[model samples]
Target: MGKAIELNQVDTIYEGEKIPSLKNITLHVDKGEFIAVIGPNGAGKTTLLETIMGLLESKRGEVKVLGKQLNGNGSNIRKLVGYVPQEYSIDDLTPFLVSDVVLMGRYGKIGLLKPITKNDKTVAKKMMEYLGISELSNRPIGKLSGGQAQKVMIARSLAKEPEIILMDEPFSNLDFEARREVSEKLTHLHKTKNMTFVIVIHDIASIPKVCNRVIVMDSGKIVADGKKEDILKPELLEMGYKGIAC
Candidate 1:
């Protein structure tokens, strides 16, 4: 198996910002690896994930996914990569159904104007079932709880059958029980489907047990990267989290 993702001496700066949000981010993630990114607020965790997804253009260096460099062809790369942003909100009166929202994931592969296939619908429902949200398929996305909504997003990401998924704060706004459930679901996907996952999480305790590797970012730089056991040590975590138990 080859590398699933690679960042070589990459630097990305947001518009109007003098300092790059990601600095010298040279890293390689192999296929089938489950990686957890943890750090304090403003640690550039989100920035790094966005760069990998090609959502944020890099100021310098190269980001390659699935053996292709992400340049003007980001949309092509996105067809193979599923991404769940860190923040998403639904208006109270929005009429989009849960199934519709999930089916949208297929748009990256099938195109927006093209006809939807039976296989696409089947995949969307199957993903919802896998995430234990099948019963809510017909419900309005705006009506579901935060946890349920997050699950929908995950299902949507899976609906595309992506080779790799990049999720930012997948467990945010959820209670402990919801967090555990989601973590277990992700573990099942990793083991059964061999889908690579790179998740950015703020809660240290929320890091899934299946994630063997952890990458720590601080001040737009990768301060540390190692096994979960080593990087989760308070001394090492303190460098990014300031002993605050992030």
Candidate 2:
């Protein structure tokens, strides 16, 4: 498989901060691989995903996505990477419908000033159907539950036709059943769609079930990177998370 993402000694420091959020992190993800980035809070998992998504500027090192550098020439690369944030920050009073939100994903490809076409609407509806959220299409985004909102987010991401999708703590606030359902759907998508996925997750148990490989982070550094069986041992789990047993 071809390399989908590569990071070499990457570092990023937010303004007015003493230490960088990401410190000399080096990693690579191959095409069609499902990698779960596991760590405790403030371990730089989200920073790593944002940096790769071109949402954060790096202070040092190299980040290449789909063979293209992610510094200044990341516009095209960003198009190939779909991002599902941990939480959807929607205005409670905003009147946008679910179908409208899904169609927004195509705005990047459609460009500004041009209205959404009939074909775009058709594609968005199809994506909603694929995600099993077609019934919620006309409902307001703010009215959906966490799990339903998450499904809409997934449909929105899929509408972009991204080859690689990055999810940041996607199952954080969900119930056990919802988390399992979403994970199963994601696993199915990974297999059937040939999509490369890198998800940031705090739960260690979910890693072995959802990801083929797991990368463990601690204090903004990657402490362990290996197959799920190799990295999920008690010793490594203790290194990254406190009061946790494997």
Using lDDT, give the best candidate's number: 1
Per-residue lDDT value at 148 in model 2: 84
TM-score of each: 0.92, 0.89
RMSD of 2: 3.8
What candidate 2 gets wrong by more than 4 Å, as runs, is: 71-73, 113-115, 208-210, 235-246
User: Tens digits of per-residue lDDT for model 2 on 144-176?
Assistant: 887788888877877887889998877776677
Error of 1 at 159 (Å): 0.7
lDDT by candidate, in order shown = 0.88, 0.82
Q: Give the residue spans of candidate 1 off by over 4 A.
A: 235-246
**Steric clashes per prediction:** 0, 0
Shift of residue 192 alpha carbon in model 1, Å: 1.6
